[model samples]
Target: MGTSGDLPDGFGPTIGTLGEDPLVAGVIERYPSAPWLTVGPGDDAAVLDLSGSRAGALIACTDTIVEGQDFRRDWSTARDIGIKVAAQNFADVAAMGGRPHTLLVSLTTPADVPASWAHELADGLAAECSRAGAVVAGGDVSAGTEIVIVGTALGSLATPSAVLRSGARPGDVVAVTPGSGRSAAGWALLRAGLVSSAFEGLLSEHRAPVPPYPAGVEAALAGATAMIDTSDGLVRDALRIATASSAVLGSSVVLDLDPGALAASDDLLRAASALGVDAAAAAEWVLTGGEDHCLLACFPSPAVVPAAFRVIGSVLAGDSGVGVRLGGKPFDGEGGFRHWS
Candidate 1:
């Protein structure tokens, strides 16, 4: 079978770029790593080594998404689970200001589950990796009660010393990249059926965190002194930076909401009114809800904050406490999400 794009001399697709697709080696093959390996997927494990900089410490992160604890059987599909797992782990890497190079996955599922489900899961993983410009190097499969995903990622750093949480100054410009609190509003809507048309995008955001992975790298490249991903909650993340860098964290609203976020908030406000859910309480959820997977950072120069960076608040010198202020006034309420009260 041949087409216009096919080789007229019988050189099929396989015979073209692959050199020898069916070629089998009786002996074990070996190749040494080089400066220009790019990304070799055929190897047992993909290896990416960043050069030109003096940094040389490997930061590894591993996370597990269980069927019940992380993802509900009724809410998310297998592919969704895989994508979430990868996204969450990558978020952690970004929080540390590292470039994710390779990912390893392990899957455990019930024997009765559809085989296509696992294939789709792999597809989802690959899709996210492609979006993140990484690769699915190797993974394992086993039996389990339900869907479970384990991912281990390798990260490259510009320097061994990274933009940690513990290093904010009293007047450092506190900023965030592409902020969104719609996840919390969407969750409430799903529970109360108060979802409105304006907030549907927020519902999708709640389902999957759309973090700017490159933002971390850019922030670090732009000399971000301290940074953390907004996974646990903004307050919790700010606390981590405050503790790690021995700095106090403070925030003030400094965002011009994008259309999606604006619409979502409006819809949620209406829905909350109908359901008796305190719409203003969204401050609590937005400041603390986990899984949003955004970035909170400190900048030395507020004027030169990265292109996508949004000015949130400032890092102050004070007692180790989380506080919030409104309209240039300090209000009495806590910020961020905390697990178990």
Candidate 2:
């Protein structure tokens, strides 16, 4: 029943009553009113003003992370979890060619979870929102058996129409932001118990990925034909755009990727060697890794591709259903993470 100011530094015996808990109060206190948020936390529902945008359309996306399924407390801190969830949601809005505007967060945790942990999680979420040019309007917290965090991001389009997965064309060029395979390599290192400082950067990325928040808007402005967030692996997500575009365009689409364009970086190669794996394994991580949250987009031509994006492949007419090919051969390697598999 103590105020947020009176909360102790370490984990308490259990979370207190919801009505008088410091965790909720602390989280509410952390967010202030913004120009876009007419009503913030401490209210039943947040009121956002979108009239300022030239394009009145709204973009919304939601993503969830569970305790054991999406993350582990031993490997990632509350702040890390917050950053990861926020980044993923923001990336979704960006992929749609929108500017991230506000976020609604919902958190459920076991009674054993400390108030400090919850507060830290709020800080992490707020920090990421600031980085993405957005705000945390409001959210809910409840008691549960395990930690569950969900983020619903609402954004405003910068262009007349939001870019979609079905907008790709046969002659479009495929491109991606700078990061790929870093998160997967980080996961590999963590799973193998290879916590050496040499792999700290990779481990950090796995814990909390830093997505290219601005590149989405940039691509849209530069006339990107289609775009997607690389939450799944490169090939899997690229295939998503191909499939969607194919259905709309009435022709099978194939994304022909150049292997040299996606070669493993030096850091990835080092991690591969340390794990007793070869460069091929490292390359697989880039191809099949997920959670990096980078932007994958198709432009009308290589000349129109934004500088922030690197040309990696091209769209082509396919003889069969939509698929991805590497070096002109159909890729058969495993896809990214999937539930119930």
Candidate 3:
């Protein structure tokens, strides 16, 4: 699409006129140097010197979010989009019990789009990177039909090594960080057109997730057996750990939840009630809702979990499968966001 037939269709300004360096420069201006980075964003390549950092190994992961697929431009601002991509990327590094130090952002957008969108997006990415104690290293920008944001995070693991999902044992306790379902609840409200002052937090959560970055390292130090980011949903990711740990398919792990805990989120419950969604269905957001990016780890029985981690359930010695149970009964409803129904 375009302003006219001859002109390229874009958001704010055309990419052809400004070219790549200026846009790259805009990004470079926003991100400062981190201690671990030898060379920052402006160079031909970003170099990281972790020799003094004392990391045993390097951890890296890449993730992408596309327009219409992962998010709606109308619903999310450039800053929100930036925070989301950065936070989720950090979540993956954290899942491995590593501390993120740098990020490489790859962006694709239509030529006709405004340059400000790109700048704002960079600002958003930089902001989140700083929050995680990381910096934007370098990345690629290209023209595409839709807005696409991809972020790759680099981190280091200390003495115990990267925590794998397969480490969970049958007797381990399942634990998770705080704040679970606000994003799902917010999504429900957005879909239902129920936006209001009452739903601000939920709505914000959906736009930009805040994962517990330090908890990953904390969990590892505290002896977490297995770890994963519940970006996919609790049941699904739990199943990943269960299968990786070689638990039987029918009854390997049970993600037990407390009734009091479920009821504790007054705003989420209230949002559900306002939308006429029952308690069970609302609770489904907590169990199956994806994108909150919270850490779920398994610790040994009598696990001395870190201060931020809360024990929710336990791995069971039984058949194969992951179960989400509340009050000891199997939870009924859908779990998490799936790309395809």
Give the per-residue lDDT digits (tens) of candidate 1, residues 1-341: 36776546323222123222121110002122234235544546565655644246666789787765556645555566667777877877787778775677877766555544565566667666666766665566666676678998767775556778766666677777664566665666666754456656666666555678888888888888788887776656665666666523343222111222212255556656656767565555666566778888888778767887877776555553333333334433254444345
lDDT of each: 0.62, 0.88, 0.81
Worst lDDT 10-window in candidate 2: 11-20
Prediction 3 TM-score vs. true: 0.89
- Tens-place lDDT digits, model 2, residues 24-99: 7888787655876877888789988777643468889999999998899989888998999899999999999898
Clashes of 1: 7
- Better structure of 2 and 3 per TM-score: 2
Q: After aligning candidate 2 to the native by TM-score, how far in Å is the CA of 122 from where it should be?
A: 0.3
Task: Give residue 46's lDDT in candidate 3 (0 to 100).
Answer: 88
lDDT of 3 by residue, 218-301 (tens): 999888988999888876787677677764333465555555554437787798899997887677787788888999999986
RMSD vs true structure, all candidates = 9.2, 2.8, 4.4
Q: Give the distance in Å from residue 274's predicted Cα in candidate 2 to where it truly belongs.
A: 1.0
Q: Give the C-alpha miss distance for residue 326 in model 2, angstroms.
A: 0.6
Clashes of each: 7, 0, 20
lDDT of 2 at 271: 98
| Model number with the top lDDT | 2
Worst 10 residues of 1 by lDDT: 21-30
Winning candidate number (TM-score) = 2
